[model samples]
Target: MLWWVLGGAALLVVAVVVTGVVLFVVAAGKSDRVWGVDDVAVGECVTVSGEDEPVVRKVSCDSTDFHFAVALKADPGVCAAKNYSRLWFGEGDSSDSFGKWARDGLCLAHVYQQGRCYHLPSSKETNALADVREIDCSSPPATGAGENYEVESKVSGMPECSEEQAEYFTEKPTPTGYCLRLLE
Candidate 1:
Protein backbone atom coordinates (compact mmCIF):
# COMPACT_ATOMS: atom_id res chain seq x y z
CA MET A 1 0.00 0.00 0.00
CA LEU A 2 2.87 2.41 0.84
CA TRP A 3 4.59 1.69 -2.48
CA TRP A 4 1.42 2.35 -4.43
CA VAL A 5 0.88 5.73 -2.73
CA LEU A 6 4.51 6.78 -3.39
CA GLY A 7 4.22 5.71 -7.02
CA GLY A 8 1.00 7.68 -7.48
CA ALA A 9 2.61 10.83 -6.01
CA ALA A 10 5.60 10.48 -8.35
CA LEU A 11 3.35 10.16 -11.38
CA LEU A 12 1.39 13.27 -10.40
CA VAL A 13 4.62 15.25 -10.03
CA VAL A 14 5.85 14.11 -13.43
CA ALA A 15 2.52 14.97 -15.08
CA VAL A 16 2.57 18.48 -13.62
CA VAL A 17 6.13 19.11 -14.77
CA VAL A 18 5.38 17.91 -18.28
CA THR A 19 2.25 20.04 -18.50
CA GLY A 20 4.18 23.14 -17.37
CA VAL A 21 6.92 22.53 -19.94
CA VAL A 22 4.40 22.08 -22.74
CA LEU A 23 2.56 25.27 -21.84
CA PHE A 24 5.82 27.23 -21.74
CA VAL A 25 6.88 25.94 -25.10
CA VAL A 26 3.55 26.83 -26.68
CA ALA A 27 3.57 30.34 -25.21
CA ALA A 28 7.10 31.00 -26.36
CA GLY A 29 6.31 29.87 -29.88
CA LYS A 30 3.33 32.17 -30.10
CA SER A 31 5.30 35.13 -28.80
CA ASP A 32 8.12 34.58 -31.30
CA ARG A 33 5.81 34.07 -34.25
CA VAL A 34 6.71 36.29 -37.22
CA TRP A 35 3.79 38.13 -38.79
CA GLY A 36 3.35 39.14 -42.40
CA VAL A 37 1.81 42.41 -43.59
CA ASP A 38 -1.69 40.99 -43.73
CA ASP A 39 -1.30 39.31 -40.38
CA VAL A 40 -0.62 42.63 -38.66
CA ALA A 41 -3.24 45.03 -37.37
CA VAL A 42 -3.37 48.77 -36.86
CA GLY A 43 -1.26 50.21 -34.02
CA GLU A 44 1.33 47.42 -34.35
CA CYS A 45 4.89 48.35 -35.21
CA VAL A 46 6.95 47.24 -38.20
CA THR A 47 10.27 47.79 -39.90
CA VAL A 48 10.39 48.80 -43.57
CA SER A 49 13.40 48.38 -45.83
CA GLY A 50 14.39 48.09 -49.46
CA GLU A 51 14.08 50.77 -52.11
CA ASP A 52 12.60 49.27 -55.25
CA GLU A 53 11.08 46.26 -53.53
CA PRO A 54 10.32 46.99 -49.90
CA VAL A 55 10.63 44.29 -47.28
CA VAL A 56 8.41 44.90 -44.27
CA ARG A 57 8.45 42.86 -41.07
CA LYS A 58 6.17 43.15 -38.09
CA VAL A 59 8.02 43.81 -34.86
CA SER A 60 7.43 44.71 -31.26
CA CYS A 61 6.49 48.31 -30.54
CA ASP A 62 9.47 48.66 -28.24
CA SER A 63 11.90 47.26 -30.80
CA THR A 64 14.75 49.59 -31.74
CA ASP A 65 14.47 48.59 -35.40
CA PHE A 66 10.79 49.54 -35.56
CA HIS A 67 10.42 52.31 -38.12
CA PHE A 68 6.69 52.71 -38.64
CA ALA A 69 3.37 51.81 -37.09
CA VAL A 70 0.52 50.27 -39.03
CA ALA A 71 -1.83 53.18 -39.44
CA LEU A 72 -4.23 51.24 -41.63
CA LYS A 73 -4.37 48.06 -43.66
CA ALA A 74 -6.17 48.89 -46.87
CA ASP A 75 -5.96 48.54 -50.62
CA PRO A 76 -3.31 50.30 -52.70
CA GLY A 77 -3.47 54.11 -52.97
CA VAL A 78 -5.63 54.26 -49.86
CA CYS A 79 -2.84 55.89 -47.92
CA ALA A 80 -2.75 58.97 -50.11
CA ALA A 81 -1.86 61.37 -47.38
CA LYS A 82 1.27 63.34 -46.73
CA ASN A 83 3.96 61.63 -44.66
CA TYR A 84 2.16 58.27 -44.87
CA SER A 85 4.26 55.67 -46.67
CA ARG A 86 2.46 53.01 -48.67
CA LEU A 87 3.78 49.50 -49.23
CA TRP A 88 1.86 47.94 -52.09
CA PHE A 89 2.12 44.26 -52.87
CA GLY A 90 1.63 42.52 -56.23
CA GLU A 91 3.21 45.31 -58.19
CA GLY A 92 6.02 44.33 -60.67
CA ASP A 93 5.50 40.60 -60.15
CA SER A 94 3.15 39.21 -62.77
CA SER A 95 2.38 35.95 -61.04
CA ASP A 96 -1.39 35.36 -60.94
CA SER A 97 -1.09 33.19 -57.86
CA PHE A 98 0.57 36.05 -56.01
CA GLY A 99 -2.63 38.06 -56.37
CA LYS A 100 -4.20 36.12 -53.51
CA TRP A 101 -1.71 37.62 -51.05
CA ALA A 102 -1.83 41.04 -52.68
CA ARG A 103 -4.86 42.55 -51.00
CA ASP A 104 -4.77 44.51 -47.76
CA GLY A 105 -1.25 45.86 -47.96
CA LEU A 106 0.12 48.17 -45.31
CA CYS A 107 -0.17 51.90 -44.79
CA LEU A 108 2.64 52.82 -42.45
CA ALA A 109 3.16 56.05 -40.54
CA HIS A 110 6.58 57.20 -39.47
CA VAL A 111 7.18 56.59 -35.79
CA TYR A 112 8.63 59.85 -34.57
CA GLN A 113 9.67 60.35 -31.02
CA GLN A 114 9.45 63.83 -29.55
CA GLY A 115 12.69 65.66 -28.78
CA ARG A 116 14.68 63.50 -31.18
CA CYS A 117 16.40 65.13 -34.15
CA TYR A 118 16.23 63.60 -37.60
CA HIS A 119 17.72 64.42 -40.96
CA LEU A 120 14.92 65.02 -43.47
CA PRO A 121 14.74 66.18 -47.04
CA SER A 122 15.03 69.94 -47.26
CA SER A 123 14.27 70.43 -50.91
CA LYS A 124 10.75 70.57 -52.29
CA GLU A 125 11.79 68.11 -54.97
CA THR A 126 12.09 65.24 -52.49
CA ASN A 127 9.60 63.79 -50.08
CA ALA A 128 9.77 65.43 -46.68
CA LEU A 129 10.23 62.21 -44.80
CA ALA A 130 12.54 60.62 -47.32
CA ASP A 131 15.88 59.36 -46.08
CA VAL A 132 14.94 60.05 -42.50
CA ARG A 133 17.80 59.34 -40.13
CA GLU A 134 18.21 60.19 -36.50
CA ILE A 135 20.96 62.67 -35.77
CA ASP A 136 22.56 64.21 -32.70
CA CYS A 137 20.79 67.44 -31.82
CA SER A 138 23.93 68.97 -30.33
CA SER A 139 25.77 68.71 -33.67
CA PRO A 140 23.62 69.32 -36.75
CA PRO A 141 24.60 68.74 -40.36
CA ALA A 142 26.27 71.44 -42.46
CA THR A 143 24.18 73.92 -44.47
CA GLY A 144 23.74 72.01 -47.78
CA ALA A 145 23.53 68.49 -46.34
CA GLY A 146 19.86 67.68 -45.74
CA GLU A 147 17.64 69.48 -43.24
CA ASN A 148 17.82 68.72 -39.52
CA TYR A 149 14.55 68.92 -37.62
CA GLU A 150 13.78 68.16 -34.00
CA VAL A 151 10.40 66.65 -33.22
CA GLU A 152 8.66 69.12 -30.96
CA SER A 153 5.35 67.39 -30.36
CA LYS A 154 3.14 64.58 -31.56
CA VAL A 155 -0.57 65.19 -31.96
CA SER A 156 -3.61 63.51 -33.43
CA GLY A 157 -5.52 65.07 -36.35
CA MET A 158 -4.57 68.43 -37.97
CA PRO A 159 -4.21 70.76 -35.06
CA GLU A 160 -2.04 73.78 -35.73
CA CYS A 161 1.44 73.46 -34.32
CA SER A 162 2.13 75.66 -31.30
CA GLU A 163 5.51 76.66 -32.66
CA GLU A 164 5.15 79.20 -35.45
CA GLN A 165 7.90 77.75 -37.61
CA ALA A 166 7.14 74.08 -36.91
CA GLU A 167 6.62 71.90 -39.96
CA TYR A 168 3.92 69.28 -40.02
CA PHE A 169 4.31 65.66 -40.93
CA THR A 170 0.89 64.07 -40.99
CA GLU A 171 -0.36 60.52 -41.62
CA LYS A 172 -3.75 59.42 -42.81
CA PRO A 173 -6.25 56.88 -41.48
CA THR A 174 -4.58 57.14 -38.09
CA PRO A 175 -4.20 60.87 -38.64
CA THR A 176 -1.27 61.13 -36.29
CA GLY A 177 0.99 64.04 -37.00
CA TYR A 178 4.29 65.35 -35.72
CA CYS A 179 5.40 68.94 -35.33
CA LEU A 180 9.04 69.37 -36.24
CA ARG A 181 11.01 72.53 -35.79
CA LEU A 182 14.08 73.21 -37.89
CA LEU A 183 17.20 72.64 -35.84
CA GLU A 184 19.43 75.57 -36.57
Candidate 2:
Protein backbone atom coordinates (compact mmCIF):
# COMPACT_ATOMS: atom_id res chain seq x y z
CA MET A 1 0.00 0.00 0.00
CA LEU A 2 2.81 2.43 0.89
CA TRP A 3 4.66 1.75 -2.36
CA TRP A 4 1.49 2.33 -4.38
CA VAL A 5 0.74 5.62 -2.57
CA LEU A 6 4.31 6.91 -3.08
CA GLY A 7 4.27 5.94 -6.75
CA GLY A 8 0.95 7.67 -7.34
CA ALA A 9 2.18 10.89 -5.70
CA ALA A 10 5.40 10.87 -7.74
CA LEU A 11 3.44 10.37 -10.94
CA LEU A 12 1.15 13.28 -10.13
CA VAL A 13 4.16 15.55 -9.55
CA VAL A 14 5.73 14.59 -12.83
CA ALA A 15 2.49 15.23 -14.71
CA VAL A 16 2.15 18.68 -13.20
CA VAL A 17 5.76 19.54 -14.12
CA VAL A 18 5.22 18.45 -17.69
CA THR A 19 2.03 20.47 -17.96
CA GLY A 20 3.77 23.61 -16.71
CA VAL A 21 6.63 23.21 -19.14
CA VAL A 22 4.24 22.70 -22.06
CA LEU A 23 2.24 25.76 -21.18
CA PHE A 24 5.35 27.93 -20.96
CA VAL A 25 6.63 26.75 -24.31
CA VAL A 26 3.26 27.38 -25.98
CA ALA A 27 3.08 30.92 -24.66
CA ALA A 28 6.63 31.72 -25.81
CA GLY A 29 5.85 30.49 -29.30
CA LYS A 30 2.69 32.58 -29.56
CA SER A 31 4.59 35.71 -28.63
CA ASP A 32 6.69 35.31 -31.76
CA ARG A 33 3.79 34.41 -34.05
CA VAL A 34 2.66 36.73 -36.84
CA TRP A 35 -0.27 38.94 -35.90
CA GLY A 36 -2.86 40.71 -38.01
CA VAL A 37 -2.75 44.45 -38.55
CA ASP A 38 -5.66 45.25 -36.21
CA ASP A 39 -4.26 42.94 -33.53
CA VAL A 40 -0.70 44.27 -33.59
CA ALA A 41 0.35 46.62 -30.82
CA VAL A 42 2.79 49.47 -30.55
CA GLY A 43 6.50 48.60 -30.62
CA GLU A 44 5.88 45.50 -32.73
CA CYS A 45 7.47 45.22 -36.18
CA VAL A 46 5.43 44.81 -39.38
CA THR A 47 5.72 44.50 -43.13
CA VAL A 48 3.48 46.61 -45.35
CA SER A 49 2.32 45.56 -48.81
CA GLY A 50 -0.24 46.30 -51.50
CA GLU A 51 -0.33 49.82 -52.84
CA ASP A 52 -4.07 50.11 -53.53
CA GLU A 53 -5.14 48.77 -50.15
CA PRO A 54 -1.98 48.45 -48.13
CA VAL A 55 -1.80 45.21 -46.17
CA VAL A 56 0.05 45.21 -42.86
CA ARG A 57 1.21 42.14 -40.96
CA LYS A 58 3.10 41.82 -37.71
CA VAL A 59 6.46 40.09 -37.91
CA SER A 60 9.35 39.37 -35.61
CA CYS A 61 11.52 42.45 -35.19
CA ASP A 62 14.62 40.47 -36.11
CA SER A 63 13.09 39.05 -39.28
CA THR A 64 14.81 39.91 -42.58
CA ASP A 65 11.50 41.02 -44.10
CA PHE A 66 10.75 43.52 -41.35
CA HIS A 67 10.09 46.96 -42.81
CA PHE A 68 8.52 49.28 -40.28
CA ALA A 69 7.93 49.45 -36.55
CA VAL A 70 4.48 50.53 -35.41
CA ALA A 71 4.64 53.97 -33.91
CA LEU A 72 0.98 54.79 -33.43
CA LYS A 73 -2.35 53.21 -34.31
CA ALA A 74 -4.80 56.06 -34.56
CA ASP A 75 -6.44 58.61 -36.86
CA PRO A 76 -4.24 60.16 -39.56
CA GLY A 77 -4.62 63.68 -38.18
CA VAL A 78 -3.45 62.56 -34.77
CA CYS A 79 -0.09 61.59 -36.28
CA ALA A 80 0.38 64.91 -38.05
CA ALA A 81 2.23 66.46 -35.14
CA LYS A 82 4.67 63.59 -35.03
CA ASN A 83 7.15 62.66 -37.74
CA TYR A 84 5.67 59.22 -38.48
CA SER A 85 4.63 58.11 -41.96
CA ARG A 86 0.95 57.31 -42.38
CA LEU A 87 -0.73 54.28 -43.99
CA TRP A 88 -4.46 54.63 -44.14
CA PHE A 89 -6.60 51.57 -43.47
CA GLY A 90 -9.00 52.47 -46.26
CA GLU A 91 -7.12 54.28 -48.95
CA GLY A 92 -8.43 54.92 -52.50
CA ASP A 93 -11.86 55.49 -51.08
CA SER A 94 -14.15 58.28 -52.30
CA SER A 95 -13.57 61.78 -51.09
CA ASP A 96 -16.81 61.76 -49.07
CA SER A 97 -15.49 58.88 -46.93
CA PHE A 98 -11.98 60.30 -46.70
CA GLY A 99 -12.43 61.54 -43.15
CA LYS A 100 -13.64 58.18 -41.89
CA TRP A 101 -10.86 56.30 -43.63
CA ALA A 102 -8.26 58.75 -42.40
CA ARG A 103 -9.47 58.17 -38.87
CA ASP A 104 -8.56 54.50 -39.18
CA GLY A 105 -4.91 53.94 -40.03
CA LEU A 106 -1.49 53.24 -38.59
CA CYS A 107 1.45 55.56 -38.18
CA LEU A 108 4.65 53.76 -39.11
CA ALA A 109 8.32 54.58 -38.87
CA HIS A 110 11.07 52.91 -40.83
CA VAL A 111 13.28 50.33 -39.09
CA TYR A 112 16.58 52.07 -39.66
CA GLN A 113 19.25 49.59 -38.73
CA GLN A 114 22.68 51.00 -37.99
CA GLY A 115 25.26 50.58 -40.79
CA ARG A 116 22.60 49.68 -43.36
CA CYS A 117 22.33 51.72 -46.57
CA TYR A 118 19.07 53.10 -47.97
CA HIS A 119 17.87 55.14 -50.94
CA LEU A 120 15.47 57.78 -49.73
CA PRO A 121 12.74 59.29 -51.83
CA SER A 122 13.34 62.35 -53.93
CA SER A 123 11.75 65.64 -52.94
CA LYS A 124 9.39 65.40 -55.90
CA GLU A 125 8.02 61.99 -54.82
CA THR A 126 4.61 62.39 -53.23
CA ASN A 127 4.70 59.17 -51.22
CA ALA A 128 8.03 59.20 -49.47
CA LEU A 129 7.60 56.05 -47.42
CA ALA A 130 6.60 53.95 -50.41
CA ASP A 131 9.73 55.01 -52.29
CA VAL A 132 12.22 54.28 -49.54
CA ARG A 133 14.37 51.28 -50.43
CA GLU A 134 17.31 49.48 -48.91
CA ILE A 135 20.51 49.04 -50.89
CA ASP A 136 23.68 46.94 -50.61
CA CYS A 137 26.58 48.97 -49.27
CA SER A 138 29.16 46.83 -51.14
CA SER A 139 27.49 47.37 -54.50
CA PRO A 140 28.04 50.42 -56.68
CA PRO A 141 25.50 53.25 -56.62
CA ALA A 142 22.52 53.02 -58.92
CA THR A 143 22.71 55.04 -62.14
CA GLY A 144 21.23 58.58 -61.94
CA ALA A 145 19.57 57.90 -58.58
CA GLY A 146 19.72 59.89 -55.36
CA GLU A 147 22.68 59.29 -53.10
CA ASN A 148 22.44 56.28 -50.77
CA TYR A 149 22.64 57.10 -47.10
CA GLU A 150 24.13 54.83 -44.41
CA VAL A 151 22.81 54.96 -40.89
CA GLU A 152 25.48 56.24 -38.54
CA SER A 153 23.55 56.39 -35.27
CA LYS A 154 20.03 56.42 -33.84
CA VAL A 155 18.89 58.78 -31.11
CA SER A 156 15.78 60.25 -29.57
CA GLY A 157 14.17 63.37 -31.08
CA MET A 158 16.20 65.30 -33.66
CA PRO A 159 19.70 63.90 -33.99
CA GLU A 160 22.63 66.30 -34.06
CA CYS A 161 24.15 64.94 -37.22
CA SER A 162 27.32 66.46 -38.62
CA GLU A 163 27.43 68.51 -41.83
CA GLU A 164 28.23 65.37 -43.79
CA GLN A 165 25.41 63.45 -42.09
CA ALA A 166 21.68 64.05 -42.61
CA GLU A 167 19.02 63.73 -39.93
CA TYR A 168 16.14 61.33 -40.43
CA PHE A 169 13.39 61.80 -37.88
CA THR A 170 10.53 59.51 -36.83
CA GLU A 171 8.22 59.11 -33.89
CA LYS A 172 7.92 55.57 -32.52
CA PRO A 173 6.46 56.56 -29.16
CA THR A 174 8.22 59.75 -28.45
CA PRO A 175 10.41 61.72 -30.84
CA THR A 176 13.26 59.66 -32.28
CA GLY A 177 15.66 60.28 -35.15
CA TYR A 178 18.71 58.89 -36.90
CA CYS A 179 21.96 60.29 -38.19
CA LEU A 180 22.84 59.13 -41.68
CA ARG A 181 25.84 59.80 -43.85
CA LEU A 182 26.31 59.35 -47.59
CA LEU A 183 27.35 55.77 -48.39
CA GLU A 184 30.60 55.99 -50.34
> Could you tell me which 10 consecutive residues in candidate 1 have the lowest summed lDDT?
92-101
What is the C-alpha local distance difference test score of each model?
Answer: 0.64, 0.67
Model 2 C-alpha lDDT versus the unseen true structure? 0.67
lDDT of 1 by residue, 1-184 (tens): 9999999999999999999999999887665222455567788876654443445566777765326777777776566654466555554543221222355566667777778887765433222333556788999887475678888877787646774556565555467677788877
- Which residue pairs does candidate 2 place in steric collision? 157-175
Per-residue CA lDDT of candidate 2, range 28-95, in tens? Answer: 87663333347677887777554433445667777654288888888656656776666665545433
Estimate the Cα RMSD of every predicted model relative to the unseen true structure: 6.4, 6.7
| Global lDDT of model 1 | 0.64
Off by over 4 Å in 1: 32-34, 47-67, 80-82, 88-104, 119-133, 140-147, 159-166, 171-173, 182-184
Q: What is the TM-score of candidate 1?
A: 0.58
Residue 34 of model 2, lDDT score? 36
